[model samples]
Target chain A: MRAKTADKIATSIIIAVAALIVLVLAGLLGYILYRGLGHISFHFLTSAPETIRKGGGIGPQLFNSVFLLVLTMLITVPIGLGAGIYMSEYAPANRITNFIRLIVEVLSSVPSIIVGLFGLLVLVNLFGFGFSLFSGALALTVFNLPLMVRITEQGLKGVPREQKEASLALGLSKWKTITSVMLPISLPVVLTGTILAAGRVFGEAAALLFTAGMSSPRLDFTDWNPFSPFSPLNPFRPAETLAVHIWKINSEGLAPDAAEIAAGASAVLVITVLLFNFGARWLGRYMYRKFTAIK
Target chain B: MNSIIEINDLDLFYGDFHALKHVNMEIPEKAITAFIGPSGCGKSTLLRTFNRMNDMIAGTRIEGSVEIAGTDIYSDEVDVETLRKRVGMVFQQPNPFPKSIYDNIAYGPRLHGITDRKKLDEIVETSLRSAALWNEVKDHLKRSAFSISGGQQQRLCIARALAVEPDILLMDEATSALDPISTLKIEELAQELKDRYTIVMVTHNMHQAARVSQQTVFFLNGEVVEYSETERLFSNPTDQRTEDYISGRFG
Candidate 1:
């Protein structure tokens, strides 16, 4: 009887804690939506900023955020994935590998503001890229690479040893086994990591501030040329992403409706990050099912 | 019968631990040879040496020679990939590759560069049939390998090993984790497979050795306690250790 009573009390306390977390998340989301939804309008979403007017959209900033994300992912995926495979499958587990791992862990734990400083020094100033999308993407890559490598390594290591043994026993070479068997098995987890990294890239303001700069050129939507300064395809142009724009509007925005714009931008940023987290889980499940045929 | 695998003064060590000590044995071709011993007696270790599967383990060292069909497998000229191709192995657990049934069987053939769809289909069929799982799984070839029962999964593993067209099939306690019915099915499958491929199995069940294998090797403390014709060894003992073990006197 005493044991059952203790169990009941423990269960209630756990439930109360879980409920508290849910309530906090719900309250925060509700509060943001309530304040921001009123300011979100068709004109506010599509038109460029007008310093003299009350209604100005974050059109260029949105495009810049999406473009920056694409460029960063393009650079980070191949290098991070290859490094992960080498670390997990080929490298001998000696002091050298351990030391490298320790370095990666330390790098991952470094504050984003420090990474922004690094980008400002090496990519923006030293390399003379001069506040452009390319510099920003490179900065984000350095910030996210350690995370990708760590996640991919864990995903690869999570695979059962029997799978590798079975593949090798069938006379497949080690590389072949890794490519055909191991990679496919670890695909879902790797993809989840990629999405999570993307979410981080989407919202990162500190790193982009120093590397991408706080201004955007007037883009010619019709210009498809990669070399044009105003073309969205040009990586050399200065891009002000959504998070950075929000930061700019909050601190030094000169427009009459700066507070409203900041609220709307914050809402959009939060929504995008939420979508990424949810999409990561959904896609991970879908891939696992497709590959393993589990219901 | 001619000998297919010859182990001469073979010794195996895992770091400071001596696993198999100066073992010598000859396994006949197209016959079922069984290795039986108590836990950690190195029966499985000897089995792994046939394909050099122990090479994956850190601090593992092999001394002397293990030759298959007169070719020394450990020689510098030998490619480990080609050697493994000729000698396939099945593990204690059912380890399907979390792929479609067709893909699981086709995985081995695909690795060796067999890309023709019809050829892969045909190989999948024959391998599944040889493992005696064709009738049960024929309709679900496109389904996931994990969708099947444990017994079916083990049989799928057997079919996978067979898909490589190996000269020898090594079973390391293949049915030790199965139900009685599954165990019976695998034991029967092993008997049938021996007619085509040289089958070597390590088992803890003495009765399984008696029922399935033509030759039986008993191991204890990293040494061969007794090895002879299965019938002779079981019915009339040459070694007292073999007699004691068969009669269920301490392993």
Candidate 2:
């Protein structure tokens, strides 16, 4: 009788703990949607409200946010995945790999403000790019690189040793084994890492603040030209992403309609992050099923 | 059978630990040779040494010459890729790649620059036929290699190795992970394959050693205890250690 009573109490405690977790998640999701859903609109998504302008759309901000996310993916994907390959496949479990891993962990733990400060000194003042999309993308690259590298390394390491040996045993070279066998096998996880990094790029505000600057929205196509080298990509120009725009509206207070604008921008940001996280997860699952079915 | 591979005073070490010591052995051409011993007796290490697969391991050192077809394969002049092409390997588990059955077999030929679809198809068919797996997998070559059972996957791996037309095949306990019926099928395939290619296999099963191989090498504590005909080794081994190993005493 005593043992059964104790078992019942234990089961109730476990159930309560699980319910607590559900309640907490519901609370977080509810708060964000409740505060944000009311502000979303077409004008809020598209128009870029210029200095002291009341109820103008955030067109430039939306464009800049998308641009930064894409550029960061370009710069970081290769470097991150390459680093991961080196760490997981080529690297030995010795002092060198351990040291590199420690450094990466430390980098991930560093505050976003510090990453912003580093970008300001090294990228803006020292490098003569005051503030622009390029600088912001580079800063975000540094922030997201560690994340992708770690995740990809873990995924690659998780691959069966037998698969690698099988490839090599069949006279495939080291690079071929990596590209043809290991990389493809672990690609879903690598994509997840990249998507996570993109989410950070979209949501980040502190790091892009000083590096990307707040010089009011501009849609100049002259500097945006990609094929020419005669015109330098002028980083002195200010760029506004959605997250930065929200922060700007809250601080400046010149626009009395800033509250709705902030809520709407937050909604867009949340939706993007949700889509990225779920999209990457879905893609990973699809690839796994599709590939595993044939083998 | 004539000798195709010669190992003279070959020694292997993993850091300070001596793995294979003073291994002098000759593997005959186009014959199935079985290496029988308990685990960690350096059979697999010696096998890996043939193609320098142990080069991937850190602090793994090899001493002495492994001459294949009158060439010291371990020489600095030897390209690892070319050496691996001539000598392919299979593992204990059926590690069919996460690719289609046809693609897995064609990976090696493709690496060597055979890109024509008709030629690739020819190679895949011939390889699968040689492995005795063509009939089973002919209609489903487009299917994933991982979709097959353990036994079938092992056969696919064999076909994959054979696609390159390697002169030698190194199998490290290739049938240990299969069912009894699967093990018999692989044994029969190995015997069939021995007519055209040199086969070096490591096995823990005593009956498998006797049944599949014509030549047998018994190893104990990194040393070649005895080497003789399979019948002689199983029924009339001279060395006490060889007798012990064959009779299920101590390896």
Candidate 3:
């Protein structure tokens, strides 16, 4: 009876902690939505900023953010995935391999600001990309590569040993087995990792400030030519993303309705990140069902 | 009684630990040969060497020759993938790939580059029938392999191993994890399969070896204690260790 009461007490404590966490998260989200949702008009979303006035839209900044995400993912996915596969499947269990794994772990834990500075020095200055979107994409790639590789390796490693052995036993070549059988089974985990990294990339601000630049060059949606300076597709142009825009407006206080713009942008950023997380989970579940045929 | 597999002076080591020492035996073609031994007796290790499945293990080294149809399996000229294709294996657990029933059986055939839809369907039907599971799973070919019961899944695994047209099947305690009825079903299936593919099985159940195997090899301390006809090995007194093992004196 004493033990049972103790168990009940422990269970209650755990439940209380969990409820507290949920409450805190709900409170934060509710407060942000309450403060920022009113400023979100269609015009506020689509129009470019006005220098003299207070309440111009964040159109260019939003476009730049999405464009940067697409560019960064294109560069990061192949390299990160390749490194992960090599480390998990091919690398020998030697001191050198252990050292490499150790380096990856340490790199993943390093501050994003430090990575941003490194990118500013090597990519923005040394490579002479000069505060362009390309430079920013490279910076974000460096910042997120360690996370992607680590996640990918962990996901692959989570696949059951029997699956690999069964594939090989059936005469599938090592590479074929990995690509066809192993990768498919671990697809859910890999997708989750990709999305988690994506969510982080979508909201990242510190790294882009030094590498991607603090202000956009006023994009022209009318001019569809990718090569033009004002076109959204120009990788060489300076791009200010949403998170950075919030930081810039708050710190500079130059725009008349800087406080309102900052609140609205923060709300958008929070909502987008939440969407990314939810979308990732849904996609992961869908892939798992399709691959496993678990109707 | 032509022997299809010949193992000569086989010695296996896992890093510094010696697993099998100076072992040898010939396995007859198209017959069920059973290895009956206690735990850690190197029966499974020897089974793995037949298909070169031990190559995946780190620090696993073998010094000998395992010849199947006059070809040395461990030779540099012999491809491991090719050797494995010819020597299919079913593990202790029923490990069905996370695919539909049809896809699971077609997995091996597709790996070897068979892409025709009609051909894959035929192979899937034939293999499942061979494993004696086609009747149960025929209506739900598109269902996940995991949707079936455990017994059915084991048979699915057997069908999967058979689909690749392998000449030999290595079953490493394939029935141990099953129920009595499932075990009997598999035993009957093995008896039927022995007409085409050479079957080598390792089992802890002495009655299983006596019931199904034409020949039985008893192992103790990484060495073959006796290799003889199943009836004689079970009934007659040749080596005291073999007699004791059969009589349930000590494993």
Interface alpha-carbon RMSD, every candidate: 1.3, 2.2, 0.8
Residues A128-215, model 1: lDDT tens digits: 9999999999999987999899888988998899999999998898899988888889988898889978988899999999999999
By summed lDDT, the worst window of 10 consecutive residues in model 3 chain B runs over: B237-246
Model 2 ranges off by over 4 Å: A1-18, A50-53, A220-236, A285-295
Order the candidates by DockQ, highest first — what do you get?
A: 3, 1, 2
lDDT digits (tens) for residues A44-125 of candidate 2: 7766574566776676777778778887898899899889889987788989889999999999988998898999999988
Candidate 3, B64-182: lDDT as tens digits: 99999999898999999988999999999999999888989999999899999999999999999999999999999999999999889999999999999999999999999999999
Question: Over 4 Å off in model 3, which ranges?
Answer: none
Tens digits of per-residue lDDT for model 1 on B1-251? 99999999998999999999989999999999999989999999999988889999999998999999999998999988888889989899999998899999998998899999999999999999999999999998989998898899999999999998999999999998999999999999999999999999999999999999999999999999889999998999888888899999977
Better of 1 and 3 by TM-score: 3
TM-score list, all predictions: 0.97, 0.93, 0.97
- Where does candidate 1 clash, by residue pair? none
List all candidate RMSDs to the true structure: 1.6, 2.8, 1.4
Q: Model 3: per-residue lDDT, tens digit, A1-295?
A: 9999999999999999999999999999998888888888889899987665877888888788878988998988889989999999999999999999899888888788998898889988899998989999988888678888987798789889888899999998999888878888888778877887787778899988999999888777888788999888999989999989888888885778878888888788888788878977887788777777888
Q: In candidate 1 chain A, what residue range of length 10 has the lowest lDDT sum?
A: A44-53
For residue B10, model 2's alpha carbon misses the true position, in angstroms, by: 1.3
- Residue A141, model 2: lDDT of 85
**Best DockQ goes to which candidate?**
3
